[model samples]
Target chain A: MRYKVTIAYDGTDFAGFQMQPNERTVEGVLTKIVNKIAKNPGKRIQIFGSGRTDAGVHALGQVVHFDMNTQMNEDNMLHALNSMMPLDMSVKKVEIVSEDFHARFTTHGKRYMYRLSLGEFVDPFKRRYTGHWKFPIDIKLIKAAIKDLEGTHDFSSFVAAGSTVKSNVRTIYEASVRFDDATQEIVFEFYGNGFLYNMVRIMVAVLIEIGSKRRPVDDIPRLFQVLDRNEARGTAPASGLYLKKVYY
Target chain B: MRYKVTIAYDGTDFAGFQMQPNERTVEGVLTKIVNKIAKNPGKRIQIFGSGRTDAGVHALGQVVHFDMNTQMNEDNMLHALNSMMPLDMSVKKVEIVSEDFHARFTTHGKRYMYRLSLGEFVDPFKRRYTGHWKFPIDIKLIKAAIKDLEGTHDFSSFVAAGSTVKSNVRTIYEASVRFDDATQEIVFEFYGNGFLYNMVRIMVAVLIEIGSKRRPVDDIPRLFQVLDRNEARGTAPASGLYLKKVYY
Candidate 1:
């Protein structure tokens, strides 16, 4: 039986969503727990994530798919999965899914949020959850820059190196920047058809550069035209990025 | 110069505030950094904290004091200390305090905040920052129970089992319970002369019991009269507690 699970993780302690040798990772732990429940070597199965998140990146509504030897009720599955979860991760929901429903292939769009702190220094309690930006930011500049990010665009400039994918073009359905009063930090949200490797973090860095007046507000389109990663200042720290959602 | 440093830390990965062999701790890290800055074996000095927080507990304004071999400007001191701080901790402020101003010995109150999440299941992202209470909580009952907590009292019932302190008597200047709308969590704040080992967590447990209708609304006074730790339901998880401030 195949099942879909929605999981959330603190991500501060995780190496990433992918598994690695001798490292504590979200996928590694989850795989261990789910397989442990199967209790038989023959019933062992592999789990699939919507996408990979880099080391130190977080997620709220990350979805995953897996198959078990026998069908189980959702509540029992949720209880079984969540009860064994570590303090930093939880399987929030579980549901039976079609055998053909793939976690990665079905993803049509994604939403990501990046948080940057404006404090003169990094707040200790927020160190794991926010990326610090010491420079003064003009919200108006970022807001103006965000207008150029809406709709379809070639985001080659934002994609990080080490890409094996052929296409750098993606459609951003929504792009927004705002100050989160409660957290006292700047929040940037991007919803796009698909994001390339480190795309969100790179875009966040470019927007921060615009917000700090290091670049013109209308420079995003020019970067697309240049099709060069060097035009982007730097990738924002992974600590502040959250995979908010993956819409199928 | 004797310097008073206000520090904040996310204690999720710490063994506790006090140092222990082969364990990561807040005090150990601070002492190491401070002594590193002293730069002379002969000038090595001990660091003292206002109080200790248990493993997984957090702090926003915890204060400490240490004497240095030489006087240093506050900005440079702040920068020097903070730059070397681990990701989970930060030195928020440094001041050249009077020789007599001891962090733990100064006669004043302290402020603590306990965060309890009302979610049916633990939110993984908040696992390090909030305690989960699955039961439905009545804010009014908890609020009423909070009133009995204000002012001076012999809080023997709230003290943990292993406390060796001779006096359980302490003055609570103020106590209040409020719902934080932004996080959808119940926040309990206490200002007092001092707190015993695990006192705040025990009181929080008792109050939560009251909110959940397991005890009388005015049971706090009776718990004080009982002078027994068993009277409290259970200690809340350390993750929910934060040492908000140490008043000198």
Candidate 2:
């Protein structure tokens, strides 16, 4: 039987999403618990996530799927899994699904949000979750640049170095930057069919640079023509990135 | 010159607000930085807080006063003190005030906010800042009880055991509970001329019990007459309490 699970995690302590030999990764912990629940059903159960999240990245609705032979119901599985999981991670929901429904391959689109704290001093409570950018930013320039990022385009310049993907073409259905008055936070939300390795972070860095007037607002549209990674600014930190939602 | 400073701190790592012989405290850290900035002006400077906050209690606008023999202006002092203070503590403002001004004695009232996360799954990001209460609550009962807590009353029943204050009488100016639908959090805000030791926490505990139907709704006003500390519910955890503001 196949099961789909929605999970949320604070990635501050995890190495990343993928399983590594010795490091504490989200996948490593999930796999440990899933197999333990199988309880010698003769085969180790394996879980697959919607996508990999980098270290220090958070997730609000990350979806995953796995196969298990146990007769445990969804409620019992959720209770048992959450009871043994660490404090930083939790299983929000679990449901039985058709075997054909794959968590990764059957995905349609995803949404990611990057949070920037614009205050003079970093908020101690939000230090672990938000990227602190104390420099002044021109909100008008950022709004203009966000408009250029929407639509289907080959985001080669925004791809991180060492990414071996053969295709850099991805569709960004929506992109916008909004300032939260109460918290003095700048939030960048991106919705797209897919994203390249560190693509969102790199795009955020360029937007911030443009917002700060360090780079011309026209540079965003110009970078698409260059198709060179060096033409883009540095990638933003992973702490600000959140896997907001996954669609299937 | 005497300086009055507005401060904010994440108390997750501090023992409390007061300086102890060996504990890591907000006052201990602030005093160290102030003295270092003083640079052997001859006497070791001491800091006086508006009041002591218990361990794991956060503060958003705590006021403190101290004397220093330094020529540095407010801007430079703010920069120097913040640069040297630990990541968990920060000085929001520094102003030279009259020597007659006192942080504790000049006070007229204070406002406290206690956050409760009533969801089945606690938000991982807010886990450190809010208290998780998973039990179902009756909002109507809580609202009625909140109204009963306002106004002047002898809150001897709400004081913590071993508190040495001569008078447990305090005036609650405003008390209310508002539910935030977006975060599914219940925030209890209290404004009072003064709060007895653990008074707000105990009040919250009894309110929660009433909300959960574990205790009768009239128990709030009834406890005021009993004047017995043992009559109240257990004190709420310190993690959920925040010294929101101190007024003078």
Candidate 3:
């Protein structure tokens, strides 16, 4: 039977989700805990996640699925798995899913939130979670640039160089930028069918530069037509973005 | 003429705020950056901070002051100093105060905020920014425990051992907790005249235990009456709390 698992993790302490022989990964850690709890320490479980978040990136509704040989009891598995996981990562919920359910292949959509702290006062407490930009980012220009990102188009301009993807075309459902004056957080929330490697980060960099008036808003649409990586301005730092949701 | 300045830092990647030989510290990094700008190869700028936050701990208003003998505009100094500092640390404001603006001694009040992600969904993005507790925390229990903590009190029970403070009596202006449903972040903001070493951390540990109902809330008040350190629970993790403000 296939099992659906919901997880919570502190990515600061992890290298990423995929396993490396010498380094710690979210998938490796979860696999170890789940296998230990199942009393099959030798069992190698392959957990397929809805997305592959980069190192230092984080998620809330990160979904995954794996098949187990033993009889499935969702409540018992949830409790047992959670008890065995490390303090930084926990399996919050577990359920039995149909054989047809695939965490990655069946993912219908995804939502990501990019948090930027723009002001003189960069709260040290929020430094790890938000991107700190000291200069004034022109909101109107960023909003104008975001309009160019909406809808389906060839996204080769936003994809990072050396990516292995065969196709650069993807559909973006929504893209918007808004600032919270009280907290001084400029949050950009995006929903899309999928993203290429470092696509979101590059998009953010272009938008932020546009917001700073370093690049014109019209450059977004123009860059979409170019297939070269150096044609885009820059890639924003990875610290500001989060995998907020993965819908399936 | 020499001037004093204040600084704030996210100490996750720093050894500490104070400079140490051959180590990455807030002071060490600042000193390097400042010296680079002033072109003073042999100059030593002494940077003094209000308190030393441990590794992984954060400071929203970590006060620091230093003196330099170079002629640089305030805007230039701000730009140059920040250009050299790490992205996690920022100079909120620089003022040419009276030569007497001691970063530590002239402070009147201060505030710290301890954040806890108290629910199931732990956003990977916010992992470094908040402490996660999977169990349900009793808000009423935490409130009851903190009631005894308000006002002037000798907080030796909450202060970490080996701290060289002669007195633990400190006046608290405000002590409370708030919940953000949208983000599922539970924040504890405390405004106090000063704090003993690890005072906020120890208090958070006790409160967290109480909130989890692992210990009775009345135990907090009872433990305060005792003079021994073993009477309370564990110290809260350093990642959970932050220096929010320094009122000078």
Model 1 chain A — which ten-residue stretch has the worst lDDT?
Answer: A118-127
lDDT of 2 by residue, B81-166 (tens): 88897867788889999988999999999999999987777667777788888889988899998989999999999999888999
Could you say which candidate leads in TM-score? 1
Q: Write the per-residue lDDT of candidate 3 for residues A110-199, one digit (tens) a residue.
A: 888888987665565576577778787888889888978999989988888778988999999999999887677889988999999889
Task: Summing lDDT over every window of 10 consecutive residues in candidate 2 chain A, give the lowest-scoring window.
Answer: A119-128
Model 1 fnat?
0.74
RMSD in order of candidates: 2.0, 2.3, 3.6
Candidate 2, chain A: TM-score against the reference: 0.97
lDDT over C-alpha atoms for residue B225 of model 1: 96
Candidate 2 backbone overlaps, count:
0
Please identify which of the two predictions, 1 or 2, would achieve the higher TM-score against the true structure.
1
* lDDT by residue for model 1 (B1-248), tens: 88999999999899999989999999999989988988884855788999899999999999999988675788889999988999789888899988999999994989999999987678877878899999888999998789899888999999988999999999998999999898999999999999999999999999999999999998998998999888886999999999999997
What DockQ would candidate 3 receive versus the native complex?
Answer: 0.34
Candidate scoring better on TM-score of 1 and 3: 1
lDDT on C-alpha atoms for all candidate structures: 0.90, 0.90, 0.79
Residue A204 alpha-carbon offset, candidate 3, angstroms? 3.2
How much of the true contact map at the interface does candidate 2 reproduce, as a fraction?
0.39
